[model samples]
Target chain A: MEFTNALSIATPELIVVIGAMVLLLVGAYGGDKARPAISLLSGLVLIGAAVASATGPLGQAFMGAFVNDSLAVFAKVAIYLASAVAILLGHGWMIRNNQARFEYPILILLAAAGMSMMASAGDLISLYVGIELQSLALYVLAAFNRDDAKGSEAGLKYFVLGALSSGLLLYGASLIYGFAGSMAFDDIAAAAAGAHGTSLIFGLVFLLCGLAFKISAAPFHMWTPDVYEGAPTPAVAFFAAAPKLAALVLIARTLGEGFHVIEDQWRQVILALAVLSFCVGAFGGLMQKNIQRLLAYSSIANMGYALLAIAAGTTVGVKAMLVFMVLYMVDVTGFFACLLALSRGGRPITQISDLAGLKQDRPGTAIVLTMLSLSVLGMPPFAGFWAKVYVFGAAIQGGLWIFAALGLAASVVAAFYYLRLIKLMWFDPSPGLTDPAPRDAQWVAYAAAAFSFPLVLFALGWLDGFAGTAARALGLG
Target chain B: MIAAIAFYVLAAVSVFAALRVVLASNPVHSVLWLITAFFSAAGLFVLMGAEFLAMLLVVVYVGAVAVLFLFVVMMLDVDFVKLREGFTRYMPFGAVVACILLVEMILISAAVAARGAGAHAPGVQHATDVTNVEAIGRVLYTDYVYIFQAAGLVLLVAMIGAIVLTLRHRPHVKRQDIHTQVTRDRKKALAMTRPETGAGVRPEDLV
Candidate 1:
């Protein structure tokens, strides 16, 4: 009976892993022609696993290593959906560049599997495993375009920084184990509640630093821009969306579950990181010429917003984070879809200068890019605006007025860069470069834009219910 | 008592070899030192009764990776003479750091020894039936399961990071197109050809 229960709980992760393995084998044998089918099949499998997770019992499983709950289900759904869209956006580029290999979809599926595992991780060990699984897949994906020098450089930079962070995390885990005598989240929590020692505190700080790097929060975000800029655009799109969502959920779970007793110790650390992330993300993006790098900084800022919600440690804050992340994912996907469609001869047109006069050559894509960029800048009637409003409101309700104010200031600073992109797209003259949108690329752009539209229209209705459900799931009244 | 002495000796050798891994002048020497370190570490692990990890470290790290490292180092055209020239400049600082580290280790060991043997905590018994490996495995698979899993993830990330850093694409070079190669006609690539005769060409040339 216990074995069956464990299997049931582990089923979602198992399904994705098995699917990924199958894809890997197919890639090994099927050659280039098998890429599209494999990609679609993997995407469908991810969606299926996410849906399956939703129907499972809502509690810890596998001897308290994995959790199956509404929160995990929700995060899994978001990650899977984003990954599916990213695969779709990548397809055209892959085919055009003769890179439509089986490895591409398989790697994406593996990464998604990792994120799914992370979402369900109920203990420290499981969390680290999930995080590493996802990160490892992503590292490969980041430099998948092995022929591109920049891609290789990006991969190298990400690896070096990532290894250092992992070491820090391991040391932190060891310290925590030494202090608490257990690696289980509940055990750690119990120990922390009884005795809040210096070693435990230091361990928690290091742990947070490791997670902060994953989320690309400030002081630990130096790798974000370089990695994003150097990675293939589709990989960047995946990086900016799914992993951030998963990492944020993990952070929330860690703080809310393990360190609930020592909130005073961690709250200030989170707040400082949140502020730095916001400032850097907002202001740093202003000078970026590469669209991908700009989005990377933007992702850092957005993650900061999510962190703000997590830092609140209120039920409402958790709910707000879920809503904010969902909306952020949609907006970012739309933005990347536009960028992906603007590529020429399989090479991404990432520079801000390349986007000049885009309106004249590809009016539809330009319009979508404009809306997405505006939404990113938090314009009214867009999904991003409502997401920010709810998050900032939650901050205020939690009496974190200073954080709210800083967020608002950062948002204003961030607006200049988003608007600058819009201005170049609409007002600048076309550079007479051939339009890069093949037939399939156009479809991806349309799908992304169409998805963003509904998100905006349904934001109010979606937020109320999603927030309530998330709040309840988080045990916040 | 014999086991303890052997364990201490192996540990000391492992530490010494590891130090030499960093201090050795030539890259080849460094790799050799690393292999030695692995062997000593494995021996220490065996003394601690972790046969699996010991065997794995020997077979995988020492036998394969270290050997590969040695081979690569041997192949590279490293200017060992230049590398030696800088040794004098940094030796004093390096020695001081090493001394500090040794002192710290001595203090830690002395503290632990002072704590004495069989100083078991209350309600905690040293198991008599299971070996150290089994004891550790039991704890790892049960109580510390999450951490064990987390460690796996860290390794996975490291593996990916290593692969990504080393994988580079060069476009200018002429490379075989797998697609074209797979579909090529055998006759086109391996045909029996006749020699061409030119003006004033010899009969041997024509043949």
Candidate 2:
């Protein structure tokens, strides 16, 4: 590919890279004093990249190894937006803890760039590279506080489990190459359609296992709680929202597009995974005292819902999944925003008990948290509710009523934990510990909470058009 | 042909050293074995025409990861003396397993050799010009693109996990507060007291 064409094709990533480098230079020169300004600049650059990706021409590039399709464009936009929000939420926490450093924004930008690459990755090799870039940046971010033992332990567990998953994925990729004589998704689809082999199927199974780990899908999701609990709150927020969305999209792109021909083999595997994820997500959150761990379990269940839409393997299913993911990201971001706001002294307030009587102390944030928590549980008049409905509707259309029923049951189980959080915030007595409000955190709380109201109100009207466009873009119909 | 033979020999050495990395009793020995394994792997890569990866493996993995292992083992208070105590008991079973693995490898090699050279060779068109590095680059940038991308993501995740695992927060430890330390004034932190030498007070106490 010509350099200009490559630049044009990779503009989103290029923007982030340039921005990160400039921030790093500025940070080094300005020392600790320049971190806030650099972080804000990085956030703007991320927003710009998201906008550029949305407006950019959509197609394949680099010999079809990277694709710039509507689905990729939309997913990149979501990833960038989430990254921006994460940076905003993290700014206050970093400053308060005196851990605000140049590497923070740079790593965030690099991770965002990686996620963007992952979203558009058209071939397995590109996909692997994108994921590693994202993962490496995140690893640093997770353990950025070198003095914290818990943070270090979280990073270690995540590394070991992540390495094992990577090994599984690489072995699967080699097997796929061996069986299909090609690693491009398009080529694999064509090869697998005509050929029959056990190796190919086994490779697919292993590949799914790796992707499952990424999205924190059940059975492959052992590392989620420990990692979430161990990392700093903002890092956990970024983990819970952005990477999971990218992984889900990549999973859909691979299975829904590339392996559509062998749906019979993968369908059962996905169905089993979906059921397992749902049960685990619901039941796992119940016993969690730490809010971050609770959210981790919630993420698992949410992924199950997203997988349900994917399991349909229809165009409607793809659109529904996309809509669901977008809404879920917003809802989860809002929830984290509230958690980030609930600080005592200079430290972030964590643990379920820490949120007691938040309704009295921080009424606005508590209200937003309640709405967001309700949305997460699939309550009506919220974006998550509509997202779930579309997913269930897709499932029913595909005649997977049993899965839909399981989803409803899981939603109920999810509600129990979310409601417990709400009760703690409202019904419980106030701890009466007061701390000065951090300006940046207050803004994040307002923004996250305010964003959800419109999401809830406009979800129904928004879905039909969004779903139609997504369907057409994906060639689902 | 010579290059191919060298590659095979290096590859065998690398595999043997890697096996030793896991089986060696002393952590220090395991690290040393790992360094040798990395060197042999690098040599094989060079023969296969991956000059960049060969250099990277030698410089980064051997120089950094293996050295880190050695340093960590040296610094740790592990009793190497006790580790050797159980080796004799496990020797017979280990030997039997090694023999079975060797037999399987020989059989696999014979099967591959029976298929002949041309069976596994590239097509006639551009075969001479298609160096191993070029072929790998082509496949990586094209056919195996997603897998390559995924590998990077895995590494990134592993890196993050490592940091999270090692971070420590000690609540009770007394550490220097730079802000407070830097802002201290001589007038506030230090006092010059003048005591009266009277009313039966000792001179030392007054001073």
Candidate 3:
């Protein structure tokens, strides 16, 4: 009976894992000939996981090591769906390049399963397991094109650095468990809320260091640009979307649920990270030529905003983070999708200047790419603008006006690069005609672009209410 | 007490062996030094009354891990000297990293020193009658069953990831067809050809 309840609560993750195993069997038997079917089935499985997450038996189970509350459900749905889009995007690119192996979709499916586990993680053990599962798959995806030297380097660097960070995280977890005598967040909270020790603070700081590395916050973000620049384009798109949200949600849970009493201590560390991330992301992006590297910097800056919102440590703050992340996830994925769709003379576009003649060649892709850029830069009439507004409002409400001002300044500097991209796309002389866009990538780009602008207005009311309910799930006023 | 003296001698040798493991110029020497360090660490664990953990340390780290390191060092023809040539070029960056680590260490020490006697655990006690292994098993089976499974999944992912990254199937390679092999019967296998007792079957007759 106990096992049944736990499995019932973990149904969404189980669905994804079981579906992936079944797909793996099919792929293994049918070989490379079954890749396309496997990819489509994987996407459907992710959508199924999202649906299950949405319609759920919301409760905590597994000895309170997993929670299926509003917050986890909301984050899990976004993660699963974004990863589904990633699978669709990868399928098209893989076929075009003849790297369409069946393992690709299954790896993605498993990674998505791991990310959902991160969303629902209620204890440190689940948290570490979830992170490792996702990361091990991603390390392979980074080097998916094993023949490419840059891809292999990216994979090795990511794996080595990621292992170090995991070590740091585990060390902190051990310290916390040693001090508190439990791995469950509630027990940590119960012990920490009363007679806290500085060791607990130290553990929290180390834990934050590891979590900050996950979001690619400044001072721990050395690997982001290289990994992004070197990984396959579709895989880069996947990296830019779901993993950031999963990491941020994990950070919020660890801080909000487990260490809220010491918010004063953790907030300072978060703010420092936020401030450094803002400056570094803005200035570093200005010098990047590779579009993937530029987006890496952009993600770093966006994480700074998410950190600022989290530093507020309020219900409104968590709500702001949710809004920003979901919106940003869509925009970034679309932007990369646009990159995936367009090519010049059969060569994939990797450089910013490669987009110069895109307007004349593919007007639809050019237009939508511009919309995504505007949305990410927080221009009016786009989804990202409201995301920024909510973030800043939360900051100001939490007496972080100075930080909000810093975010604005960073946004202004960030706009310079976005405009440079636009100027090149629209004004520069034609390089040459691009290859025709693939159906799947073209559609995903269009849908995401549409979501970033007109559709977002409709989504805003529902998303805000949804985000509010999720914020309330943490039991913070 | 002799227990105190044993602890000091073990600790000193462990630290020295660890330093040698890093500073050894030869890869083979490094592996040997690493094994020594592991042995000393296991000895230290023994002195601390964690005999089970000490046995595990020797069995896992010394017997398995150190031997694996030795195999990798001997089998791979990595140019260690060439690799170290860039160490000087990266000296400044390395120094900065070292300084940052130093600061972190100091700060942590300060935090602990400032909070001296107040740092006590909430207290996790095992029954005095049960061994430590049994105590661990009780929690692992009851409260941590989900975590144990999740860890298994993590290992599974790691295995899958390694295989995916390394495994490649070359196209056009001829392979066995199991279905064809298994479904063959006596009717398909034998033509019931009778040859003369001293004569060999011709190629056409075999076909």
Candidate 4:
């Protein structure tokens, strides 16, 4: 392909990259006062990128280093929009905390660019580059509040662990290249079909292990709770949403496009990670007192269901994974947005008890929070219910009803904590009214809550069709 | 014969230094050992005919990065003795992990030995006529240009992150207003004092 044609194929990522550099200059010259303007400009840039992605031609680019397809387009729209929400949430938060700087939004824009790369990555080299690009920005965002000891600690911990995971991924990629004589997914797939060797399986396991860390699947989930609790709430919202979706989609592409022929081998690894995630997310969440930590466990369990669907290694499974994540992504983004909005005594509420008597004073927020919690816990009539149904159905259709049953049982165990939050908000004694909700988070929470039940009813048909088409783009069934 | 012997000697010393980097109790000593390990590894790369890599391993790793590592280690207020105090307490757990990793490595090596790195030799092809830098340059720009640029963005993010974390503006502290100084008219800053040269400047004039 001509270089210009390849460049056209990656228009969305290019928009973000060039936009970030331009915004960096604006911020540098305009100083802190330029933050809000730069943020809005970046949002428009993202919208433009999304439009480009949705309308652009689909094909391999850069000699198959990148590919733009239905999967990439679908995932990019969700990620870019979520990245915008994250910037909005963080803007309100930094202003409230008196640490407003222009870099926050630019960092997020850069990270979104990285996520676009991940979604479109067609080769191991692109995969590693994308993951590192996303992770580097996040490490800085995690410690955005540098004065806070906990924030700095979170950043340092995430950076160290992220580097270690990158090492594992690189080693695995090298091994695969050594064995397969290729880096492109199509070539790797061809190589994998010809060989049923232990060395390849070993390399495959390591690669998936590295990816599992990205999605915060357990035993690799050790970083999520600390990072979520320590990082600024808005940054955590971004972490819990776009990056996870990008990683999950990347994993699906790798499995469906690259390692489809080695189903029995990679499936075991995926299934094992899913089961571990189920156990850890379920049992571990029961003991959490802090709200952020509880949400961390919730995300882990949600990823388990997604991974369970993915382990099926079918087109239906991939579709289910994509749908489940987009729904879960909105649920998590709104969930954290609510956390950003609610403050008791002018201090952001950290403890569960701080939410006591929340309904009495802040009835609207309380109800929205309740709706989100119920929706996320898979209560009937909510978006999460349908998400779970599709994933479980996919797993069963793939003849993995046993694992589906395990996921259901884990969901049962997980419901107790979600119920506990609801009970505290509605029934517990009054502490005090939370401060008035910030405009950004307030609007975000309302929009997210509306989607939690009724909007999903309206949008589910489109989402299901889009996700199906996206999954089919992987050339799997 | 000499090259083979030299490879063995470099490899042994490099491995020994790497072990010492981890096992040494003193943080400063460990850093120095890490630099030694880097040196020997660079020599090994040189022996393998990858002169470009050998240069990078020296200039990038040894010359720059290792010096920064040394600075951080020496500057940190770490209580190395206290840090190492938990060695005995966690030794059993650590040893179990170490053993598991060792076994896993052995298994992978065994698999590689039995199967001969599978379907092919390696992915990177070095032409006999082309120099190492030339081959790498061609691939870096054409085949993997997107990834190379993405890596540059990663470094750019690191730079932004350092500034964001460290840079703070203080309202009270005086700063250089070089632009203002440069645009100023000299008449305001300097007053003609022809009388002061003969009679000495009055205190009021000086003020």
Candidate 5:
């Protein structure tokens, strides 16, 4: 019975792993012709994994190393969905540029599997393993365009910094394990709940720092702009969407599950990171010419807003965090889709100036960019507005009025960059005649952007209920 | 008494070698010092009764990781002098950071030692008759199997990542497709018609 229970709990990850392996074998021998089929297969595999995870019973497996619960289900489904969209959109772009390789989808599948593991991780060992698994694939994906020196440099920088952060996290984990005498989240929480210790607090600090780096929050966010600017556009899109969700969920889980007792300590640290991220994200992008770098800063700031909910340390905070992640991912994927669609004379455009007079041609892409930009700016009736509402409202309920105020001010400042991009797309004259949407995959991305409109406007109640249910299931409520 | 003496000797050598690993001007020498440090650390592990970990340290770190370090250092043509040019400039800042870390570690360890009862839970008691390896194997294969498999996945991803990052496609290289070559028919290669006797097959006739 126990064996079957474990198998059932792990079915989703197993399906993804098996699918990836099969695709790897098929892709290896099938040559370049297999890319499209494999890409489609990988997408289906992720959807299947999501379904499996959602249908599973809520409980723990692997001696409490992996948790199968509403929270895990929600996070895994979101990750798989976002990753599937990335693969669907990225395939056509890669193929059009003669950069299509079977490895792209395989890596995505592996990365998704890692993220699903992270979503369900019930212990620190699982967390570290999941994180490393995800990051290793991401580092390769970031440097996918090896011919580009900047891409290689980005990969190297990400790898080195990521490894350093991983080391710090391990150190912190060891400290906690030493203090608590167990690596399990429940044990650590119990140990802390029994009596607070300085060692446990230090461990939590280091752990939070490591997670902050993962999410590219403030002082630890030095690598975000350069990496985003240099990595291939699809990889950047993936980076901005799914991995951020996974990392954010992991943070919520680590703090909520393992260190909830020390909320007084960790909340302050999170608050500092949140404030700094908001400031840097707001002020950093004002002078940026590169579109990717601008978005990177925007993402940093967005992370700050999400961290506000985390700082609240309440059930409402957890629910708001979930809703915000889903909405933010939608906006990120849509924005990247527009960027991916932009090309003139077969050369990819990376500059904010490149969008100048884009409204004249490729009006579909221009409009999509407009909506996503508005959404990112937290304009009312857009999805980002509600995402912000939940987070800010939760903060206020938790007596974190100062953070909410800081967030509101930061949003106003951050609006300028998002609006500037829109203005460039609409008002400014084209530096050269703009090109039409160049790839079939971009239409899929446009469809994604289109879907977000209804999602933001009509799906608000569903998102709220789902997030609330998941949070309640996790006992945060 | 003998174990204490052995532990002290290993600890001293390990610390010295670790210092040399950082301070050595040549990368190759640094790698060599790193190997020494790893070996002494393994020795210390043995002195602490973790035989499996000690053996693993020697096998994995000394055997594979140290060799990898040596390979990397040998492969790169680094200018040792240029690399060290910033040493003096950063020394004070580095020293300050080091001192802070040292203080933090000392404080943490001191506190942990003082509150020793809180450091170990009574729940993880093990049978004394079991060897370390046997005990580890039992738990790892049972309770930790999933995590162990996850570690394997990390390694697999690492391998794939390394290959994808370094492997380059040589566009100019032409390779034969054996399947196509073998499937080629005799009819496609040769004309079946009989040629006119004695006259050289005209180009049209050949076709």
Candidate 6:
């Protein structure tokens, strides 16, 4: 890996890194004066990086520690775009709450860069580095509102648990390296093919555990509710969207590419995780009064659906995973945008009751939220429905009928909560949350809402085709 | 035979210190025990022929991390009784978790051992002439360069996060407003005029 080659391959991350560092210095010196400019610049930098990442030629770099491929490009673009929108949605909230510090955007940029790295990671070392980079920034972002005790508590909890998971991940990587005699995915796959030793199986289990924790799969999703409820709404929005996408991709890479030789073992583990996650996500969200926590549970359940495709252990399964992730990104981005608009008197409207009669107050916003919720429920004609179709289709195609059936049941259970939210908006009497939606939130809300629709027309051919192409590029097919 | 004896001594000391780190009642003693554990672990690393790792363990763990732990233990006013109170209440669950972890470790080690001796070595290949640090440098700089930079970014985020959490400006506190003072002009900030020496400062001038 020559210097220039590495630079070219890592242009997206480098752009974000350089931009974040410069803005960090500028923010430090400029103080309160340069906050808005820095934030705007942060969004632009993300967009620029997204463009850079999308245009780059596909190849491996840094002795195969870093890869530039269609899969990486797709994941990076989703992360960068979702993060950029998240920044925009969060900007108004940060300003309103006096939490618009320069560090907020810089940390977001760093996290996005880390996500990009995760998308492109080719080896265990790179994977660990990417996960840590993203987690560290997220730990800060989770507690960005330091004045709030809940925020501090969320940050601390996330940090401790996150650190533990990272330790587990690193230990697993080390174990795998020991067994395989290499850290590269190719060599690990070769080693795994040769023999299925107990150590190798244990290492794979630990690795899956760590990845499951990252994606908030059940049994490891303890932190999701508290962190979501405690963190700023905008940060939570970003949290619910981008990190899950990146983590899912990394799981695909690690398991599908690296540990594919032991597909039987890993597939069972993934199926069990997916089952638990679906049940937990569905049942957990039912009693949630806090809307954020409710969304948190929904996220867990959604991740379960996403994991189903990967559990199929086929190229089409990977393709379905990509499709599911892209649709999820759209739905979550819209959902959070609507959430941002639901605030009143500079304080976020966190309670489900706070959204009472939202339809009368802000009909357009309410309708958009209803649509996003419907999509999330996997109702027909929405992106979320198609996302589910592809994943369940892949599962059935791979003969995982039990998993697919359980997933369908979970979707029905989860739909109740989504419908309840919509019902509260349209039928429930007014609680006087008449404050207008924040500036710039409407655009994001509309864009996300628009994407959530038109799925039926495009998903089967275009989106599936695109995801299939990317999955093939990774040698999945 | 001497080398084997040294390795056994280091390993036993490390294991003992590690147990003491958890069992010791006093927080200060626990920190000290942790340092001992770290030192003996470094010795074990050195015995394994990874001198670079040994140096790092000593420098990073013993030198910096343990000292920081000691300072924190001494600085905080901790309620040892309260800390131990939950021990009995949570003992069953904690013990179950601990037992599970122990079992998992035993299983992993047993499996590794079953795989035979070659599995114990590090994966990276190196020239015999190269030093441990040099070999590490080669791999880290070439193969792991991006990861190294990512680690640096992680540290940067941690630094900024700490500062963000602790730094605050109270509104009521009287602090120098450098910008206001520096921007002030003589005409706006001061009234200068000729006056009789005996007149001193007038009330209007003071106002």
List the candidates ranked by lDDT, beginning with the highest: 4, 3, 6, 5, 1, 2
Task: Report the lDDT tens digits of candidate 2 across residue range B1-207.
Answer: 898789788889988999999888888899999999999989987775567788889889988988998999999888877888778788899999989967964674455456442243222244457765676677776655445544554554455345444544577565899998899898757656565666554535532
lDDT of 6 at A86: 83
Model 1, docking class: acceptable
Off by over 4 Å in 6: B115-126, B171-207
Q: List the residue pairs that clash in candidate 1.
A: A125-B146
**Candidate 5: pairs in clash:** none
Q: RMSD to native for every prediction?
A: 5.8, 7.3, 5.2, 4.3, 5.7, 4.5
Best candidate (score: lDDT): 4
* Worst 10-residue lDDT window, candidate 1 chain A: A194-203
- Per-model TM-score, in order, reads 0.83, 0.81, 0.91, 0.94, 0.93, 0.93
Off by over 4 Å in 5: A439-441, B115-126, B169-207
- Tell me the whole-model lDDT of each prediction, alpha carbons only: 0.79, 0.79, 0.88, 0.90, 0.87, 0.87
User: A216-306, model 4: which lDDT tens digit per residue?
Assistant: 9998999999999999999999999999999999999998888888888889999999988987999999999899999999999989999
Query: Candidate 2: misplaced stretches above 4 Å?
Result: B1-17, B32-126, B129-207
Give the Å error, residue A380, model 2.
Answer: 0.8
| TM-score, model 1 to reference | 0.83
Residue A129 local lDDT, model 3: 90
Write one digit per residue (lDDT tens) for candidate 3, span A241-332: 89989999898888889988888888899999998998899999999999999999999999999999999999999999999999999999
Instruction: State the interface C-alpha RMSD of candidate 4.
Output: 2.0
CA-based DockQ, model 4: 0.56
* Chain B TM-scores across candidates: 0.64, 0.66, 0.69, 0.80, 0.75, 0.73
For each candidate, report its DockQ versus the true two-chain complex.
0.23, 0.21, 0.48, 0.56, 0.47, 0.46
TM-score of the A-chain for all models: 0.96, 0.96, 0.99, 0.99, 0.98, 0.97
Tens digit of per-residue lDDT, candidate 4, span B74-131: 9999898898899889989999998998899798777777776553545455588989
Looking at model 5, how many pairs of residues clash?
0
lDDT for each residue of candidate 6 in A197-269, tens digit (9 for 90 to 100): 4457778888888889899999899999999999988899899999999999999988867887788888889
Count of backbone clashes, every candidate in sequence: 1, 50, 0, 0, 0, 0
True contacts recovered per prediction: 0.30, 0.36, 0.72, 0.86, 0.76, 0.68
Docking class of 3: acceptable
